[model samples]
Target: MTEQPNMDAGAATGTKPLAFDRWLEHFRGNPAYHRLIEADIDWNGRSMLDEPTRQAFINSFQRFELGESGDGKRLLSKAALEGDPTYLAALELLVREEQKHSALFRRGLDHLEAPSLEAHWSDAAFTVLRRALGLRTELGLFLIVESVAMGYFTALAERAPDPVLRGIGLRIATDEQDHIRFQIDRLRQGFRNTPRAGRVLIGMAWTVIAGGAAAVLAVDHGPALRACGLSPARYWRQAMVGFRRAAHSVLANPGAEPLGPLGKGVH
Candidate 1:
Protein backbone atom coordinates (compact mmCIF):
# COMPACT_ATOMS: atom_id res chain seq x y z
CA MET A 1 0.00 0.00 0.00
CA THR A 2 1.17 3.53 -0.69
CA GLU A 3 1.81 5.86 2.23
CA GLN A 4 -0.43 8.86 2.67
CA PRO A 5 1.17 12.29 2.39
CA ASN A 6 2.14 13.56 5.86
CA MET A 7 0.08 16.40 7.27
CA ASP A 8 2.13 19.45 8.23
CA ALA A 9 4.24 18.32 11.19
CA GLY A 10 4.32 21.05 13.78
CA ALA A 11 6.99 21.33 16.53
CA ALA A 12 6.54 19.31 19.73
CA THR A 13 5.78 21.10 23.00
CA GLY A 14 5.90 20.65 26.79
CA THR A 15 8.24 18.24 28.64
CA LYS A 16 6.66 15.29 26.86
CA PRO A 17 6.13 15.45 23.12
CA LEU A 18 2.53 14.35 23.71
CA ALA A 19 0.67 13.46 26.85
CA PHE A 20 -0.59 10.34 25.11
CA ASP A 21 2.82 9.25 23.78
CA ARG A 22 2.00 5.52 23.73
CA TRP A 23 -1.15 6.11 21.70
CA LEU A 24 0.74 8.39 19.29
CA GLU A 25 3.28 5.63 18.65
CA HIS A 26 0.47 3.14 18.03
CA PHE A 27 -1.26 5.47 15.57
CA ARG A 28 1.99 6.04 13.68
CA GLY A 29 2.53 2.28 13.40
CA ASN A 30 -1.05 1.24 12.50
CA PRO A 31 -0.82 1.76 8.73
CA ALA A 32 1.17 -1.43 8.22
CA TYR A 33 -1.42 -3.42 10.14
CA HIS A 34 -4.16 -1.74 8.14
CA ARG A 35 -2.39 -2.63 4.88
CA LEU A 36 -2.15 -6.25 5.96
CA ILE A 37 -5.87 -6.24 6.78
CA GLU A 38 -6.67 -4.72 3.41
CA ALA A 39 -4.63 -7.38 1.63
CA ASP A 40 -5.90 -10.31 3.68
CA ILE A 41 -9.59 -9.54 3.91
CA ASP A 42 -11.80 -10.80 1.07
CA TRP A 43 -13.92 -7.81 0.25
CA ASN A 44 -15.28 -9.40 -2.90
CA GLY A 45 -16.91 -12.46 -1.32
CA ARG A 46 -20.48 -12.90 -2.54
CA SER A 47 -23.28 -12.96 0.02
CA MET A 48 -25.39 -16.06 0.40
CA LEU A 49 -28.38 -14.69 2.29
CA ASP A 50 -32.14 -14.53 2.14
CA GLU A 51 -33.73 -11.34 0.86
CA PRO A 52 -34.47 -9.82 4.29
CA THR A 53 -30.92 -10.25 5.59
CA ARG A 54 -29.44 -8.98 2.35
CA GLN A 55 -31.69 -5.95 2.29
CA ALA A 56 -30.90 -5.13 5.91
CA PHE A 57 -27.18 -5.18 5.28
CA ILE A 58 -27.52 -3.07 2.18
CA ASN A 59 -29.52 -0.48 4.10
CA SER A 60 -27.26 -0.49 7.17
CA PHE A 61 -23.83 -0.64 5.57
CA GLN A 62 -24.42 2.08 3.00
CA ARG A 63 -25.38 4.59 5.66
CA PHE A 64 -22.39 3.57 7.76
CA GLU A 65 -20.08 3.99 4.77
CA LEU A 66 -21.30 7.54 4.28
CA GLY A 67 -20.82 8.35 7.95
CA GLU A 68 -17.23 7.12 7.76
CA SER A 69 -16.44 9.29 4.74
CA GLY A 70 -16.09 12.64 6.52
CA ASP A 71 -12.79 14.50 5.93
CA GLY A 72 -12.37 15.59 9.58
CA LYS A 73 -11.24 19.07 8.58
CA ARG A 74 -12.69 20.59 11.75
CA LEU A 75 -11.17 17.93 13.97
CA LEU A 76 -7.77 18.50 12.37
CA SER A 77 -7.99 22.23 12.92
CA LYS A 78 -9.01 21.73 16.55
CA ALA A 79 -6.14 19.33 17.24
CA ALA A 80 -3.65 21.60 15.50
CA LEU A 81 -4.45 24.31 17.99
CA GLU A 82 -3.80 21.98 20.94
CA GLY A 83 -0.02 22.48 20.53
CA ASP A 84 0.66 18.77 20.85
CA PRO A 85 2.46 17.79 17.68
CA THR A 86 2.30 14.06 18.36
CA TYR A 87 -1.43 14.16 19.17
CA LEU A 88 -2.12 16.08 15.97
CA ALA A 89 -0.15 13.46 13.99
CA ALA A 90 -2.12 10.66 15.66
CA LEU A 91 -5.39 12.42 14.87
CA GLU A 92 -4.38 12.80 11.23
CA LEU A 93 -3.61 9.11 11.06
CA LEU A 94 -6.97 8.39 12.70
CA VAL A 95 -8.73 10.41 10.00
CA ARG A 96 -6.90 8.44 7.31
CA GLU A 97 -7.95 5.15 8.87
CA GLU A 98 -11.60 6.29 8.83
CA GLN A 99 -11.24 7.17 5.13
CA LYS A 100 -9.91 3.68 4.50
CA HIS A 101 -13.02 2.30 6.19
CA SER A 102 -15.17 4.46 3.95
CA ALA A 103 -13.35 3.03 0.94
CA LEU A 104 -13.88 -0.52 2.13
CA PHE A 105 -17.58 0.02 2.65
CA ARG A 106 -17.92 1.68 -0.76
CA ARG A 107 -16.25 -1.29 -2.44
CA GLY A 108 -18.49 -3.65 -0.56
CA LEU A 109 -21.52 -1.65 -1.67
CA ASP A 110 -20.39 -1.81 -5.28
CA HIS A 111 -20.07 -5.57 -5.01
CA LEU A 112 -23.60 -5.77 -3.62
CA GLU A 113 -24.93 -3.34 -6.24
CA ALA A 114 -26.09 -1.02 -3.49
CA PRO A 115 -25.90 2.73 -3.96
CA SER A 116 -24.25 4.86 -1.25
CA LEU A 117 -25.76 8.26 -0.66
CA GLU A 118 -23.77 11.43 -1.36
CA ALA A 119 -25.11 12.92 1.85
CA HIS A 120 -27.22 11.67 4.73
CA TRP A 121 -29.46 13.87 6.86
CA SER A 122 -27.87 12.43 9.99
CA ASP A 123 -24.38 13.10 8.69
CA ALA A 124 -25.24 16.67 7.78
CA ALA A 125 -26.80 17.26 11.18
CA PHE A 126 -23.80 15.79 12.97
CA THR A 127 -21.36 17.92 11.01
CA VAL A 128 -23.30 21.04 11.86
CA LEU A 129 -23.49 20.18 15.58
CA ARG A 130 -19.81 19.30 15.80
CA ARG A 131 -18.75 22.56 14.22
CA ALA A 132 -20.93 24.55 16.61
CA LEU A 133 -18.97 23.45 19.68
CA GLY A 134 -15.40 23.62 20.97
CA LEU A 135 -13.16 20.58 20.62
CA ARG A 136 -13.99 19.12 24.05
CA THR A 137 -17.72 19.29 23.51
CA GLU A 138 -17.32 18.05 19.97
CA LEU A 139 -15.37 15.03 21.23
CA GLY A 140 -18.06 14.38 23.79
CA LEU A 141 -20.54 14.08 20.94
CA PHE A 142 -18.02 12.06 18.94
CA LEU A 143 -17.71 9.55 21.77
CA ILE A 144 -21.46 9.00 21.64
CA VAL A 145 -21.34 8.14 17.94
CA GLU A 146 -18.34 5.85 18.38
CA SER A 147 -20.17 4.05 21.15
CA VAL A 148 -23.19 3.39 18.96
CA ALA A 149 -20.96 2.29 16.10
CA MET A 150 -19.20 -0.19 18.35
CA GLY A 151 -22.50 -1.85 19.26
CA TYR A 152 -23.80 -1.86 15.68
CA PHE A 153 -20.69 -3.41 14.16
CA THR A 154 -20.27 -5.95 16.93
CA ALA A 155 -23.84 -7.09 16.35
CA LEU A 156 -23.27 -7.31 12.60
CA ALA A 157 -20.09 -9.32 13.01
CA GLU A 158 -21.68 -11.80 15.38
CA ARG A 159 -25.11 -12.15 13.81
CA ALA A 160 -25.11 -11.35 10.11
CA PRO A 161 -26.28 -14.41 8.18
CA ASP A 162 -24.02 -13.80 5.20
CA PRO A 163 -20.43 -14.96 5.72
CA VAL A 164 -19.11 -12.09 3.64
CA LEU A 165 -21.03 -9.47 5.59
CA ARG A 166 -19.94 -11.06 8.84
CA GLY A 167 -16.30 -10.94 7.78
CA ILE A 168 -16.52 -7.30 6.76
CA GLY A 169 -18.34 -6.38 9.93
CA LEU A 170 -15.77 -8.21 12.03
CA ARG A 171 -12.92 -6.28 10.46
CA ILE A 172 -14.70 -2.98 10.91
CA ALA A 173 -15.62 -3.88 14.48
CA THR A 174 -11.97 -4.58 15.25
CA ASP A 175 -11.05 -1.17 13.92
CA GLU A 176 -13.86 0.46 15.90
CA GLN A 177 -12.60 -1.09 19.11
CA ASP A 178 -9.23 0.52 18.47
CA HIS A 179 -10.97 3.77 17.65
CA ILE A 180 -12.87 3.73 20.93
CA ARG A 181 -9.62 3.34 22.83
CA PHE A 182 -8.03 6.21 20.97
CA GLN A 183 -11.02 8.43 21.67
CA ILE A 184 -10.91 7.57 25.35
CA ASP A 185 -7.21 8.41 25.50
CA ARG A 186 -7.65 11.72 23.76
CA LEU A 187 -10.65 12.63 25.88
CA ARG A 188 -8.68 11.75 28.99
CA GLN A 189 -5.90 14.08 27.94
CA GLY A 190 -8.31 16.82 27.06
CA PHE A 191 -10.04 16.69 30.44
CA ARG A 192 -6.99 16.14 32.64
CA ASN A 193 -6.89 19.72 33.90
CA THR A 194 -10.58 20.24 34.66
CA PRO A 195 -11.69 20.80 38.26
CA ARG A 196 -14.16 18.48 39.97
CA ALA A 197 -17.16 20.74 39.44
CA GLY A 198 -16.34 21.24 35.82
CA ARG A 199 -15.85 17.52 35.30
CA VAL A 200 -19.18 16.84 36.97
CA LEU A 201 -20.98 19.27 34.72
CA ILE A 202 -19.35 17.84 31.60
CA GLY A 203 -20.18 14.32 32.67
CA MET A 204 -23.82 15.24 33.23
CA ALA A 205 -24.00 16.90 29.84
CA TRP A 206 -22.38 13.95 28.09
CA THR A 207 -24.78 11.53 29.74
CA VAL A 208 -27.74 13.41 28.29
CA ILE A 209 -26.12 13.57 24.86
CA ALA A 210 -25.26 9.88 24.89
CA GLY A 211 -28.82 8.97 25.82
CA GLY A 212 -30.23 11.01 22.99
CA ALA A 213 -27.76 9.54 20.51
CA ALA A 214 -28.49 6.00 21.62
CA ALA A 215 -32.22 6.59 21.23
CA VAL A 216 -31.76 8.05 17.75
CA LEU A 217 -29.66 5.10 16.65
CA ALA A 218 -32.04 2.59 18.12
CA VAL A 219 -34.92 4.15 16.22
CA ASP A 220 -33.04 4.95 13.00
CA HIS A 221 -31.47 1.51 12.64
CA GLY A 222 -33.96 -0.63 14.48
CA PRO A 223 -34.60 -2.92 11.53
CA ALA A 224 -30.91 -3.55 10.99
CA LEU A 225 -30.38 -4.33 14.67
CA ARG A 226 -33.38 -6.65 14.66
CA ALA A 227 -31.93 -8.43 11.65
CA CYS A 228 -28.78 -8.99 13.68
CA GLY A 229 -30.85 -10.54 16.53
CA LEU A 230 -30.69 -7.47 18.74
CA SER A 231 -33.51 -5.47 20.22
CA PRO A 232 -33.27 -1.68 20.15
CA ALA A 233 -33.25 -1.72 23.96
CA ARG A 234 -30.32 -4.12 24.00
CA TYR A 235 -28.41 -2.05 21.48
CA TRP A 236 -28.98 1.08 23.54
CA ARG A 237 -27.64 -0.73 26.60
CA GLN A 238 -24.45 -1.66 24.78
CA ALA A 239 -23.98 1.93 23.71
CA MET A 240 -24.36 3.07 27.30
CA VAL A 241 -21.60 0.72 28.32
CA GLY A 242 -19.30 2.56 25.96
CA PHE A 243 -20.56 5.91 27.19
CA ARG A 244 -19.93 5.15 30.87
CA ARG A 245 -16.50 3.77 30.05
CA ALA A 246 -15.56 6.99 28.28
CA ALA A 247 -17.01 9.13 31.03
CA HIS A 248 -15.16 7.19 33.70
CA SER A 249 -11.96 7.40 31.73
CA VAL A 250 -12.30 11.16 31.49
CA LEU A 251 -13.85 12.23 34.78
CA ALA A 252 -12.77 9.57 37.23
CA ASN A 253 -9.35 8.28 36.25
CA PRO A 254 -7.74 8.80 32.89
CA GLY A 255 -4.93 6.33 33.63
CA ALA A 256 -7.21 3.42 34.45
CA GLU A 257 -7.06 0.23 32.43
CA PRO A 258 -9.92 -0.03 29.97
CA LEU A 259 -12.99 -2.06 30.92
CA GLY A 260 -12.95 -4.11 27.72
CA PRO A 261 -10.65 -4.91 24.77
CA LEU A 262 -7.59 -2.66 24.63
CA GLY A 263 -7.71 -3.32 20.86
CA LYS A 264 -4.77 -0.97 20.70
CA GLY A 265 -1.71 -3.20 20.47
CA VAL A 266 1.30 -1.97 22.40
CA HIS A 267 4.50 -2.06 20.39
Candidate 2:
Protein backbone atom coordinates (compact mmCIF):
# COMPACT_ATOMS: atom_id res chain seq x y z
CA MET A 1 0.00 0.00 0.00
CA THR A 2 1.14 3.55 -0.69
CA GLU A 3 1.86 5.46 2.50
CA GLN A 4 0.03 8.77 2.78
CA PRO A 5 2.08 11.91 3.35
CA ASN A 6 1.81 13.75 6.66
CA MET A 7 -1.59 15.39 7.01
CA ASP A 8 -0.11 18.40 8.82
CA ALA A 9 2.41 19.23 6.08
CA GLY A 10 2.53 23.01 5.50
CA ALA A 11 1.79 24.73 2.20
CA ALA A 12 5.10 26.67 2.23
CA THR A 13 6.85 23.91 0.31
CA GLY A 14 4.44 24.01 -2.66
CA THR A 15 4.49 26.00 -5.89
CA LYS A 16 2.53 29.24 -6.12
CA PRO A 17 -1.25 28.93 -6.23
CA LEU A 18 -2.82 28.65 -9.67
CA ALA A 19 -3.97 31.76 -11.52
CA PHE A 20 -7.68 32.59 -11.01
CA ASP A 21 -8.25 33.87 -14.54
CA ARG A 22 -9.87 30.56 -15.39
CA TRP A 23 -12.43 31.05 -12.59
CA LEU A 24 -13.51 34.26 -14.30
CA GLU A 25 -14.59 32.23 -17.31
CA HIS A 26 -16.19 29.56 -15.12
CA PHE A 27 -18.13 32.17 -13.19
CA ARG A 28 -19.21 33.80 -16.40
CA GLY A 29 -20.67 30.50 -17.51
CA ASN A 30 -22.50 30.08 -14.17
CA PRO A 31 -25.28 32.61 -14.85
CA ALA A 32 -26.36 30.77 -17.96
CA TYR A 33 -26.08 27.50 -16.09
CA HIS A 34 -28.30 28.84 -13.34
CA ARG A 35 -30.83 30.14 -15.86
CA LEU A 36 -31.05 26.70 -17.43
CA ILE A 37 -31.84 25.15 -14.06
CA GLU A 38 -34.27 27.90 -13.20
CA ALA A 39 -36.18 27.33 -16.39
CA ASP A 40 -36.81 23.70 -15.52
CA ILE A 41 -38.02 24.29 -11.94
CA ASP A 42 -41.55 23.03 -11.31
CA TRP A 43 -43.03 25.26 -8.66
CA ASN A 44 -46.48 23.69 -8.83
CA GLY A 45 -45.23 20.25 -7.82
CA ARG A 46 -46.80 18.99 -4.59
CA SER A 47 -45.01 17.26 -1.72
CA MET A 48 -46.78 14.33 -0.06
CA LEU A 49 -45.38 12.96 3.22
CA ASP A 50 -46.22 11.61 6.64
CA GLU A 51 -47.09 14.16 9.33
CA PRO A 52 -43.82 13.72 11.22
CA THR A 53 -41.67 14.04 8.11
CA ARG A 54 -43.64 17.00 6.85
CA GLN A 55 -43.31 18.90 10.13
CA ALA A 56 -39.65 18.11 10.35
CA PHE A 57 -39.04 19.47 6.86
CA ILE A 58 -41.06 22.57 7.62
CA ASN A 59 -39.11 23.35 10.81
CA SER A 60 -35.74 22.76 9.15
CA PHE A 61 -36.38 24.51 5.83
CA GLN A 62 -37.94 27.58 7.40
CA ARG A 63 -34.63 28.34 9.04
CA PHE A 64 -32.67 27.43 5.93
CA GLU A 65 -34.85 29.64 3.77
CA LEU A 66 -34.29 32.59 6.05
CA GLY A 67 -30.55 31.97 5.96
CA GLU A 68 -30.56 31.97 2.18
CA SER A 69 -32.50 35.25 1.91
CA GLY A 70 -29.62 37.63 2.49
CA ASP A 71 -29.24 40.59 0.10
CA GLY A 72 -25.49 39.92 -0.22
CA LYS A 73 -24.64 43.60 -0.44
CA ARG A 74 -21.61 43.23 1.77
CA LEU A 75 -20.26 40.40 -0.28
CA LEU A 76 -20.82 42.34 -3.47
CA SER A 77 -19.16 45.45 -2.10
CA LYS A 78 -16.18 43.40 -0.97
CA ALA A 79 -15.89 41.71 -4.35
CA ALA A 80 -15.96 45.07 -6.12
CA LEU A 81 -13.19 46.32 -3.85
CA GLU A 82 -11.06 43.36 -5.01
CA GLY A 83 -10.73 45.28 -8.33
CA ASP A 84 -11.71 42.32 -10.48
CA PRO A 85 -14.80 43.16 -12.51
CA THR A 86 -15.07 39.62 -13.81
CA TYR A 87 -15.11 38.27 -10.27
CA LEU A 88 -17.50 40.97 -9.15
CA ALA A 89 -19.96 40.25 -11.94
CA ALA A 90 -19.72 36.55 -11.19
CA LEU A 91 -20.41 37.20 -7.54
CA GLU A 92 -23.57 39.02 -8.54
CA LEU A 93 -24.77 35.98 -10.45
CA LEU A 94 -23.85 33.71 -7.53
CA VAL A 95 -25.93 35.88 -5.21
CA ARG A 96 -28.90 35.61 -7.55
CA GLU A 97 -28.57 31.84 -7.59
CA GLU A 98 -28.64 31.74 -3.81
CA GLN A 99 -31.73 33.93 -3.83
CA LYS A 100 -33.38 31.44 -6.13
CA HIS A 101 -32.71 28.71 -3.55
CA SER A 102 -34.63 30.68 -0.98
CA ALA A 103 -37.50 31.07 -3.39
CA LEU A 104 -37.46 27.36 -4.16
CA PHE A 105 -37.62 26.46 -0.50
CA ARG A 106 -40.42 28.91 0.02
CA ARG A 107 -42.29 27.38 -2.88
CA GLY A 108 -41.73 23.96 -1.41
CA LEU A 109 -43.21 25.10 1.85
CA ASP A 110 -46.19 26.45 -0.05
CA HIS A 111 -46.63 23.13 -1.79
CA LEU A 112 -46.74 21.37 1.57
CA GLU A 113 -49.07 24.04 3.01
CA ALA A 114 -46.38 24.84 5.60
CA PRO A 115 -45.68 28.37 6.70
CA SER A 116 -42.28 29.85 5.87
CA LEU A 117 -40.62 31.61 8.77
CA GLU A 118 -39.27 35.15 8.54
CA ALA A 119 -36.55 34.71 11.10
CA HIS A 120 -34.53 32.15 13.04
CA TRP A 121 -31.90 32.53 15.76
CA SER A 122 -29.39 30.50 13.78
CA ASP A 123 -29.81 32.71 10.74
CA ALA A 124 -29.52 35.81 12.87
CA ALA A 125 -26.31 34.56 14.45
CA PHE A 126 -24.76 33.76 11.08
CA THR A 127 -25.75 37.13 9.65
CA VAL A 128 -24.15 38.88 12.60
CA LEU A 129 -20.97 36.87 12.28
CA ARG A 130 -20.69 37.64 8.57
CA ARG A 131 -21.40 41.32 9.12
CA ALA A 132 -18.69 41.58 11.77
CA LEU A 133 -15.98 40.06 9.58
CA GLY A 134 -13.98 40.80 6.45
CA LEU A 135 -14.59 39.06 3.13
CA ARG A 136 -12.15 36.20 3.76
CA THR A 137 -13.57 35.49 7.20
CA GLU A 138 -17.14 35.68 5.88
CA LEU A 139 -16.28 33.27 3.08
CA GLY A 140 -14.78 30.88 5.63
CA LEU A 141 -18.03 30.94 7.59
CA PHE A 142 -20.10 30.61 4.40
CA LEU A 143 -18.05 27.55 3.47
CA ILE A 144 -19.32 25.81 6.58
CA VAL A 145 -22.90 26.28 5.34
CA GLU A 146 -22.03 24.83 1.94
CA SER A 147 -20.34 21.88 3.60
CA VAL A 148 -23.36 21.17 5.80
CA ALA A 149 -25.70 21.56 2.84
CA MET A 150 -23.78 18.87 0.98
CA GLY A 151 -24.56 16.32 3.68
CA TYR A 152 -27.99 17.53 4.75
CA PHE A 153 -29.49 17.91 1.31
CA THR A 154 -27.99 14.67 0.07
CA ALA A 155 -29.73 12.83 2.90
CA LEU A 156 -32.96 14.67 2.21
CA ALA A 157 -32.85 13.93 -1.48
CA GLU A 158 -32.26 10.24 -0.85
CA ARG A 159 -34.69 9.60 1.97
CA ALA A 160 -37.56 12.10 1.75
CA PRO A 161 -40.77 10.22 1.04
CA ASP A 162 -42.14 13.05 -1.03
CA PRO A 163 -40.91 12.92 -4.60
CA VAL A 164 -41.25 16.67 -5.11
CA LEU A 165 -39.27 17.39 -1.98
CA ARG A 166 -36.69 14.88 -3.10
CA GLY A 167 -36.35 16.60 -6.46
CA ILE A 168 -35.94 20.01 -4.82
CA GLY A 169 -33.35 18.68 -2.43
CA LEU A 170 -31.41 17.01 -5.24
CA ARG A 171 -31.34 20.21 -7.29
CA ILE A 172 -30.18 22.37 -4.39
CA ALA A 173 -27.61 19.81 -3.37
CA THR A 174 -26.21 19.62 -6.90
CA ASP A 175 -25.85 23.39 -7.01
CA GLU A 176 -24.19 23.31 -3.59
CA GLN A 177 -21.41 21.03 -4.78
CA ASP A 178 -20.49 23.64 -7.37
CA HIS A 179 -20.83 26.40 -4.80
CA ILE A 180 -18.21 24.70 -2.63
CA ARG A 181 -15.80 24.67 -5.55
CA PHE A 182 -16.47 28.33 -6.30
CA GLN A 183 -15.89 29.44 -2.71
CA ILE A 184 -12.70 27.39 -2.34
CA ASP A 185 -11.25 28.80 -5.55
CA ARG A 186 -11.75 32.35 -4.31
CA LEU A 187 -10.40 31.50 -0.85
CA ARG A 188 -7.28 29.97 -2.37
CA GLN A 189 -6.71 33.25 -4.18
CA GLY A 190 -7.08 35.18 -0.92
CA PHE A 191 -4.45 33.06 0.84
CA ARG A 192 -2.20 32.60 -2.17
CA ASN A 193 0.44 35.17 -1.10
CA THR A 194 0.36 34.63 2.66
CA PRO A 195 3.41 33.31 4.50
CA ARG A 196 3.46 29.63 5.41
CA ALA A 197 3.06 30.29 9.11
CA GLY A 198 0.14 32.57 8.47
CA ARG A 199 -1.44 29.98 6.21
CA VAL A 200 -1.06 27.40 8.97
CA LEU A 201 -2.65 29.72 11.52
CA ILE A 202 -5.53 30.50 9.18
CA GLY A 203 -5.99 26.81 8.55
CA MET A 204 -6.18 26.06 12.25
CA ALA A 205 -8.67 28.86 12.84
CA TRP A 206 -10.83 27.77 9.91
CA THR A 207 -10.92 24.18 11.19
CA VAL A 208 -12.28 25.35 14.53
CA ILE A 209 -14.86 27.56 12.85
CA ALA A 210 -15.96 24.87 10.42
CA GLY A 211 -16.17 22.21 13.15
CA GLY A 212 -18.21 24.47 15.39
CA ALA A 213 -20.61 25.26 12.58
CA ALA A 214 -21.07 21.59 11.78
CA ALA A 215 -21.82 20.78 15.40
CA VAL A 216 -24.34 23.58 15.60
CA LEU A 217 -26.03 22.52 12.37
CA ALA A 218 -26.45 18.98 13.67
CA VAL A 219 -27.97 20.23 16.87
CA ASP A 220 -30.19 22.77 15.17
CA HIS A 221 -31.52 20.50 12.45
CA GLY A 222 -31.40 17.12 14.15
CA PRO A 223 -35.12 16.42 13.83
CA ALA A 224 -35.25 16.92 10.06
CA LEU A 225 -32.02 14.98 9.60
CA ARG A 226 -33.33 12.09 11.64
CA ALA A 227 -36.59 12.14 9.71
CA CYS A 228 -34.49 11.88 6.55
CA GLY A 229 -32.65 8.87 8.03
CA LEU A 230 -29.37 10.64 8.74
CA SER A 231 -27.73 10.66 12.13
CA PRO A 232 -26.11 13.80 13.49
CA ALA A 233 -22.77 12.01 13.62
CA ARG A 234 -23.04 11.00 9.98
CA TYR A 235 -24.00 14.52 8.95
CA TRP A 236 -21.10 16.04 10.84
CA ARG A 237 -18.69 13.51 9.41
CA GLN A 238 -19.69 14.26 5.83
CA ALA A 239 -19.55 17.99 6.46
CA MET A 240 -16.02 17.68 7.84
CA VAL A 241 -14.94 15.85 4.71
CA GLY A 242 -16.07 18.80 2.59
CA PHE A 243 -14.55 21.35 4.95
CA ARG A 244 -11.22 19.57 5.06
CA ARG A 245 -11.10 19.24 1.29
CA ALA A 246 -11.83 22.95 0.82
CA ALA A 247 -9.25 23.93 3.45
CA HIS A 248 -6.67 21.77 1.75
CA SER A 249 -7.26 23.59 -1.52
CA VAL A 250 -6.53 26.89 0.19
CA LEU A 251 -3.70 25.80 2.50
CA ALA A 252 -1.79 23.39 0.25
CA ASN A 253 -1.08 22.60 -3.34
CA PRO A 254 -4.25 21.38 -5.08
CA GLY A 255 -2.00 19.58 -7.66
CA ALA A 256 -2.19 19.99 -11.42
CA GLU A 257 -5.16 17.73 -12.00
CA PRO A 258 -8.59 19.29 -11.90
CA LEU A 259 -10.95 18.49 -9.05
CA GLY A 260 -13.15 17.53 -12.00
CA PRO A 261 -16.94 17.35 -12.30
CA LEU A 262 -19.29 16.45 -9.49
CA GLY A 263 -21.35 13.28 -9.76
CA LYS A 264 -24.77 13.67 -11.30
CA GLY A 265 -27.72 13.90 -8.87
CA VAL A 266 -27.19 13.33 -5.14
CA HIS A 267 -24.34 11.35 -3.59
lDDT of each: 0.72, 0.72
After superposing candidate 1 on the true structure, give the runs of residues whose Cα lies further than 4 Å from its correct spot.
Answer: 1-18, 38-40, 254-267
TM-scores vs. true structure, each candidate = 0.85, 0.83
lDDT of 2: 0.72
Candidate 1 residue 19 C-alpha distance from true site, Å: 3.3
Would you list the clashing residue pairs of candidate 2? none
Model 1 agreement with the true structure over 1-267: per-residue lDDT tens digits:
111122112232233322556666776777677666557556667666677766776777778788899899988897787667777787788788889888878877776778897887888888898898777667767877887667888887789666666656776777777777777766665555556777787788788888888888887778889988999999999889878876777679744443333553221
Q: Model 2 Cα displacement at 215 (Å)?
A: 1.5
lDDT of 2 at 195: 69
